[model samples]
Target: MKNFKSEIENPIISKDILDLENKIALYYEGKIDEARFRSLRLARGIYGQRQFGVQMIRIKLPYGKVSSEQLHRIAEVSDTYSRGRLHITTRQDIQIHHVSLEKTPELWAELEQDEITLREACGNTVRNVTASETAGIDIKEPFDVSPYAQAVFEFFLRNPICQEMGRKFKISFSGTDEDTALSFINDLGFIAKLNKGEKGFKILIGGGLGSQPRPANVMCEFISVDKIIPLIEAVLRVFDRYGERTKRSRARLKFLVQQIGLVAFVKLVKEEHKALSNQTYKIDTAKFDKEIILPEIKIPSVKIKNMETYNLWKETNVIPQKQQGLFAIGIKIHLGNFYTDKARLLAHLIKKYAANELRLSLRQNILIRHVKEELLPFFYVELKKLGFAETGYNSLVDITACPGTDTCNLGIASSTGITKELEKVLTNEYPHYKNNKDITIKISGCMNACGQHAMAHIGFQGMAIKSGNLVAPALQVLLGGGIIGNGKGRFSDKVIKIPSKRGPEALRYLLNDFETKKEDKETFLKYYDRKQEHYFYKLLKPLADTSNLQQKDFMDWGSNEQYINTVGIGECAGVVIDLVATLLFESEEKIEQAKASLQLNQFSDSAYYAYTSMVNTAKALLLTKEEKTNTQAIIITEFEKLFSDKIKLETPFSEFVYQIKKNKPSKEFTTKYVQDAAFFYKKVTTYRTKTRSNGNNQQA
Candidate 1:
């Protein structure tokens, strides 16, 4: 590996990149544990892929907003380091796969040149903050949520409190009651609102989609914009203090909220008020308040070869902006995959004619904003030149899928394969359905729902089916899931399971059935609800038969050979650290960070770091006893019961730890908290040393 240059303008970002470079060196030299190093690299957006020796780097674009220069830079970097391919995720992040781990720091440095970032893009931290792609242009929106979303993203980008949590946390901002950002399925979802012309948000907390889907509860009907930040800070403090640790499956904030009732959880969140960094944090929306600037270039005269196709494109791809005389064009990207060649061309197209900005949609497409209505014909022709003028953006034909068997290790079957076949079916056979936006079809390689299969009107989860001694790729068909908007939604019901080869047939059956049985002017969700889950189950039940299987059926899509289940460890969830020594080492690191924070006058951050250090230290000792430790709340209570009598203490462990809530995060309390954590660490280390010296005494 070559030495990395630190030419970054921001001192903080320069140090961060340098730290990553140093850690990479340490890990290669066998100084840092692989698990700890993985966590560090993941927080910096360097993720391991299914393929060995290469990485998938997720570039976090806050709210999916990307400028032409940044897009060009991303394309250039992809061509230089990656395979010239960019994969847009459902969360509105772009992922470039197959890059050398050693080159990630340099890649990040180049991205930062265009004000882009990969920090906190992946790992057990605050993931990308996504909002409606039409946020600023929505006709029904009371206010543009772009600034608020950007503020939240900026506030938590490198915040120490969320850097290393038990599991990943997600936040979203919906433009209006339509909830295009899908607030009902995030850790913290904010819907924009106005009361008497005062800007505020309706908050939803603890919703998520995974193997187990849970809808978020309404945390508050309306909170002023200034108080949103403080409320979010308080919730994060509570989660950091009490969320699950040992059990990775139950560690998400959603699970925590489910275990403890919402009322009690809110109580815990309120208790952290004194420790909040801000009681009321106001955001400056002036920068984003400006109207989008459109290029002054005259519209080019282009002769349409086919007026019918152009009209269709205008109807489906062109969207009216809230601003007069401007329109947004939606480019329906296939499977969210586009190459750098087309990407660079698109970048040039936007820069030359539009507002030089594009927002990637959650449905794996692109939205070109600020295009003059006169430029519609020119855009359609130019985009057609780049092969990006696909109609049916976000319609039934625009299928959403994850790179299942292609890149993700948790993938069980081929999501992209079935997606391609189904897309072909929709495009070639049912052209009339291109305008249908009511039905959404989503696919996941596995039950984890990275593609949001659980929330789709027609969903398919990858599975494996067995017939006697033979096994074949399968999909669990689900139906009736759709967003009802306004912070309310429902998960799809599992209908049936069919072989992956039959996935296309399954879709045809469902569509044909709905087309036949549905009453006039009836929506898909209403029809499904009326007919119930059993109707769909029985309709597609014949395809579920695994008795008659062919060799080709055994093979998954996009593969020439026979199918084999090669699911690897998923990095979406944080790595598990079972080593007591590693836990103790991390505790020491946290203590040092606390001291550094205190010196910097970040008292609230310092206090939280100290609190985390105490929990880590206690958990390390408890692990040695082979005791059950799941959550931070449990660790505090259990440590007191198990170790209070053994160790000489000035105060009870519960009272000592709970002092964080009782007192404000002033200099005095921050200093006291840090000192207490240090003292507790020393005592725990002493106890461990004595126990080992006493010949492994059980009670030591």
Candidate 2:
């Protein structure tokens, strides 16, 4: 009911926010369908929470690099529109929850004041492009991958082909062979490399984690940096044309790679060369190559009250930067959460003492960059005052957990509650393992693996144990999973299922066993491999007894009420497309977008918009006859088979549509293609109208 003025310098972003406001109004007025509205809002990063009426807003932060001003702005917006809490995600994005849908536009507008965005942060588009938090300062990196990651993020933010895909796509860049960004579990993962003294990346394709986890195939041992963008574009084109649409589960790129061999997928990508916007889109790393700016003020003298604690913190949380006399400090945020009161202080501290930049890590922690060596004590003191100077950042004690039953729609059990309980267990009981980086502990509320539970050394997935019509909260303990660097990793194996309350004891059993039997200098994975999954299952099997469950066993952590698994509709997944009028309307909108792109002389973008328009129109016509239209390539082939003989056309429908793949996206070709698409839409609509006039008769 309230109107907010947008001060965003980018007119496109301003229009997007206003459009969201208009759409929200239309949906409330019963003009827009709920499904259509859901898709629109998701693209803008406004997601439906497990609790009805309140929405979750995911702020898109490319590679998790946030400026101090951006951090301040996010804190302000969170305090104003929603709760003061900020939740950092494993994807290297920040999410704020409990915001009103009607007020999202104003909230987004406020964030735009500091050059932040919400576009493509959710939905089936290119989600946040994550990278190693230690990208620029990592001593082992060949070159900084931040610039390349940022380039890809900007190139595909509003790309038409990915705007409405069958499923969400994820990409990541690991700065070095350590693979700290966890490249093995992304749709497209890039590992920074030096090939013959040239900037390049080791490319991995089609890897993903969900209900089914798949390892990415090695697409290339080395691809030049300049050509990576074009390669990604080509892969996206192939996916848009051939990826599954009808089945949500089988629609990810990983499933496509599984259905068709990686070799075939590579061949399809190569076939899209003619349609690609650029053969080599060179990135200007000069912009990202700037030196860290430090304040000229003198470092104030600070006294440490406890030398032992400070030493422990230094050994665990502090990291030496590649740059001389500089350090990077890791802030272990409990469950990746912090309030606005502390956020503002952090923003001020970094702006004045550090490099004016902070990177949110893939493990749901914050890494403060470019702090002078002498400022460690001062930074530590200041951070401790904010309740953020916790030791064991990114260690075994630094547990990663997703907002499961707390806010996520697909949460089956409680992740955050278990995470808190486990943290307490580690702190009070196993303090000696504070610096144990060999073991990773991750938890997810569901099998979707948002917490990256499947990739941890010790993983827990929320489940329910049944005993004759009664269900109790439970956890599936997993073992022997971790990143092995250089594009190699292992997905954890499910070891045993136990009651939720016994999770702490299960962890204690595993640790005690490892402590006693692990060989000297052997990692957790090696020790676990020696013992095997069955060994751990047998060890923890005693805790899996459900027949003797008590009343407290049915209660999940951090809740007073009894546990009940109520999973809502997940927005992270793809949406189903079925409405005919919506399809036709989208086609018209695509045509208009094509015209706008053409006017701007962006021939390649315009051509893709036109191609989508033609495909959408075909889908609309096919829906009228109740024919199957799943993928764009299929629609093109089926349209020719079903309508080339029935409708009079100057050229065959296949030839007309497939021209996109046969010709370069030059101005002349783009213009002709757009005109042809408009003509095809007109003819299809005319036939549909005539058929509808004849008592809704079905015609091919």
Candidate 3:
């Protein structure tokens, strides 16, 4: 992977952190006290979501490795401050959520005890560095990538210029060709390979997992270990100056990479990369290489006569260890989760059993390596001590999910909860489906696309819908998404929009339909794509109140078709993950009040107190349940007053009429910007607004 010698020697910290600590310390000390400091501080650096408030703390897990004590401590953090969960991100770092504002100092203090920190976790900064979670264990790997990921992470952790980059930065390393590391999904990816018999990395540039998803581009062949950091630095330099910052959605490196063309992007990176070091790269290659060595592994004396199940699991899980008779074991954890206590116990067991070797996977799972075949049973016994090592390593729950509403603020749907629900319901109803392979289901709470839904074979996006009078929401089903091969991948196709309550049933129906009608060895997407146009419209025909599903029949209620069928106020409009993020992050007290009184996030309780004078302040309008006799003008009158302070409707409607008549007309909202940022946020949060952005502020 991309190893540089000095990377781990001295880890970096952001200058912004120093400033934040001082400011927060002042806030905590009762000096310079302002009521808004808490919210401002939370929004500026701390992002809140479903569980505990999350800080997006990115712990540097070199080659996705962590110590036994560190694992326990992470669990402690989760249990103490978060929703008692730890997420192994696709980039091979750990993302903890639901961290409290009051706990920042303590959290930072505790993390430092284990050599971890939350500095530079978010903002326009370089994020946690990643590598092939299977780095050294996979036999095909030329060398251990742990040290390289560490080196890069260390070398640039808080590099002064990285404090305020033009946009977010991502980097990844893969130790083998099997590419379980997912190098292609980062802004810069390095895959271990040989150039003219010299071991190094083939560089891929400009890939990401956001709204505008793009598989990376190959830039050059086998950049030497010493040169990796320089190349990264060069790329960062170009991105820092050239990446678009005018729009937050268009601010990622992928946009610049695409805009400039991959060849040109590579050329720019190379020029800046070689400039600072005069093309030699200042890293001490020998020192970095010396730290990594082949470790001796023990062979188990016990031999297994029966190896069928083991062999099958091995086909999917185990990998080559450079040392003969030694194999890397991949222990799948459904949704990449294990208890902290369990993790600690496993840590102790693996440290003793596998000679201090550990690896994590992109799918939020854990991998243990360097074990002998004979010791499999012993490892299994130990794993059982931690609630793992059950049959079916790649079982249905071995599903992968992003930290959607579970921790992220931008999520639309509750991916974790929905994932859990899907697992529970699917297992109870269709247990046999667990054995099915290549059936990937990805859920994104929002269209910020953090969940990588755009690349899943079966993807679901959370969205809001206006059913007659209810503020009901639904998920937009997608098919045919995945990494095609190498770094090339396909985006999912938008198929049908189904109600949120019907998600599990919808999934079951889709899978059943696919299995029944599919030809021999036919994939889900193949069946889906063949009958694409006809399938969705036909199924959803009954679900629409006045769908006008006909391509030519458009909604004329709003100024444009885009704003039609919308409710009064909600976020995650025409989206899913965003709604999940909004609903999941609140405290129990806050949530109960919201549901009981129909309130918004920050203003829920206060809004109820102020607006309770008028009864039925919050009403759900489900269009599908209504009659066609509902006239447009009558419906508009009732809807217009729903957002007002009085119980009587005509007064509000009259005011709205007067206000609209007073304003001069310009372009429609679909083609123009409106100073309704707050109103816009509500539409998305409430799932009521029909107007939508084409996702990410970045428009091609």
Candidate 4:
């Protein structure tokens, strides 16, 4: 492979890309283990697909902001490196699939030329930092959250503290109390607020969606803008230290908070204050507060082919911006899939007429901002040519679906196929719902909720139902899930299991009953509350009857052959290697990183790296004894209990490790900590070698 070091301008990013190149070489040479290499590539946003030998590259766009030039660059890279398709995720990132593994570094270098990054887009790092697409223009917002979200994204991108955690951490910033960003489902959620003319945020912590969904707890009703970053850092430090590690199923921050009550978790977070690099980080809002410059070109006159269709488009797709006459247009992408040809055209349209920038919404759609009112007709006409002028931008017809069996390894059924059918049902049979924003529909390939099905008003999860001797593709219908606003939301309840072919019929039944029985002007959730879960189960139970099955019932949507369950190993959490030798090798690597950080005068980062090295060293030794090490906290305690007398230390093992929290990350303290960590590693290595020589080696 060719070197990408010269192509990337930023030294840090260049090094990162070059490192990926070198690691790929090492893995091919059998020098690096598959699990270890998998983690490294995943952290760089290269994911394994359901198909063998191809990769999915997730581009991390902070808060979903993308300029026309960046969009064009992405399209060019996609066309060159993979298939000419761009998939917008629910987290506001774009993914390109079916790329060769060897070409990833070059692809990443190309993206960075336009200031786009893939670092921390996947794996056990802080994933993309997302925010409301209408953030800067929302009339109800106290202030724009784009700058703050950018600040957090920049601060933690390559930070040593969060490079590897037990599970992925997600954060979001809601522009208003409407919570369009869905704060209730993130690890750290911030809602912009103003108290007595002072800028701040309402913080929500420890929320997630999977097989189990948990609503976030209100950590603080109001915290100043400057304190939010520090607060997040403290929370991450606590989670890294005590969160579950061995069990991938229970590794999320929500589980940690659930295991040890909120009060105790909060106390642990507070204990991390001393080691934090900054007590408060004031974001430079002025950088993002630039005045909007409208285009100087004359408005083009376009004849409307249909006045009625134009009127409906304006009603559902056009949004009036907070600025006097400016507007934002919403493009409801079908299942968030669009081709490069249409992408280039949309990019050109936005650059010449509207704002040069656009936001990829959390709903897997696009929001074109700063569009002038006079250009509306021209945009509609131009977008119509590209098949981009679809109505119902965020209404009931705008369904969100993940790339299920299409590419995901864990997909049990086709989310996109069923989504296409359900969307047809809404458009052809229920046209009036094009303007209805009261109900939302989402579909996920599985229970992991990548499509955020658990939080939708009407949701479907892909599954397989076995009928005695045969298996068939099925959908788990869930209802009553929706955002209640103000950092509150509810997860849907499972009502019934029906064949994927019956999904459209199930929707018709639910909609028909809702239309007939709902009270005047009642929302979907209110109506659901009145009728209850059992009521909906009874309403849709007939569709669940599988005794009378057809030939098509055995086939999944979009598949020609009969259904066969072929779930692969999921790479969403990355692979974890448990080899004792690999752990020791990783410890040495961490020590080198600590030494490099110390030389660069990054004391806080050096200290954290050293702390991690010590933890890895201890965990490796404990594994030699076949000890049950599940978390950093448990590793610390168990190591001390088993080896305290054998190894001499200046202080107790707990005190030595806990010094990272107790002492400030000063030069003297950091230098001593790194030296202590090195000494501890040497001792453990010697002990392990002695044990192995004595024929006492145990498999990890």
Clashing pairs in 2: none
**How much lDDT does each candidate structure score?**
0.91, 0.90, 0.56, 0.94
Strongest candidate by lDDT: 4
TM-score of each: 0.97, 0.98, 0.67, 0.99
Model 4 misplacement above 4 A? 696-700
Q: Judged by TM-score relative to the true structure, which candidate is superior, 2 or 4?
A: 4
Error of 4 at 346 (Å): 1.2
Ranking of all predicted structures according to lDDT, beginning with the best and ending with the worst: 4, 1, 2, 3
| Between candidates 1 and 2, the TM-score winner | 2
Q: What tens digits encode model 3's per-residue C-alpha lDDT throughout 135-202?
A: 76566677777677777877766453354454667777777775555667788888777777766788
> Model 1: per-residue lDDT, tens digit, 1-700?
4333446778778778888988989999999989989998999999999999999999999999999999999999999999999999999999999999988989998898998899999898999999999999989999999999999999988887888788988999999999999999999999999999899999999999898999999999999999988888888877876788777888899998998889999999888887788889989999888867776776689999999999999999898989999999999999999999999989998899988899998998999999888888898998999888888888999999999989988999999999999999998888889989999999999989989999999999999989788788999998988899999999999999999999999988988988899999999999999999898888999999888888899999988888887789989866867689998998999999999999999998898889888888988988988887777788888999999998667899988887888888899999989999999999999989998988757656
Where model 2 places Cα greater than 4 Å from the true spot, the runs are 1-6, 696-700
Ten-residue stretch with the least lDDT total in model 1: 1-10
What's the true lDDT of residue 99 in model 2?
Answer: 96
- Write the residue-wise lDDT of candidate 2 on 1-700 in tens digits: 4444436778888788889999999999999998899899999999999887999999999999998899999999999998899999998999999999999999988888887889989888999999999999998899999999999999998988789888888999999999988788999999999977999999998888777888889999999999999998998888888888888888899999888899999999999898889988989999778877789988889999998999999999999989899999999999999999999999999999887999999999999999998999999999999998989998999999999999999998899999999989999999988999989999999999999899889999999888667788889998888898888889999888999999999999998999899999888999999999899989999999888888899899988887787888888954866798999899899999999999999998999999999988888877777887777788888888888876667889888888999999999999999999889888888888886877645442
TM-score of model number 2? 0.98
Q: In model 3, what is the error at residue 454, expressed in angstroms?
A: 0.8
Clashing pairs in 4: none
Q: Candidates 2 and 3: which is better by lDDT? A: 2
How far is each candidate from the true structure, as Cα RMSD in Å? 1.9, 1.7, 18.2, 1.6
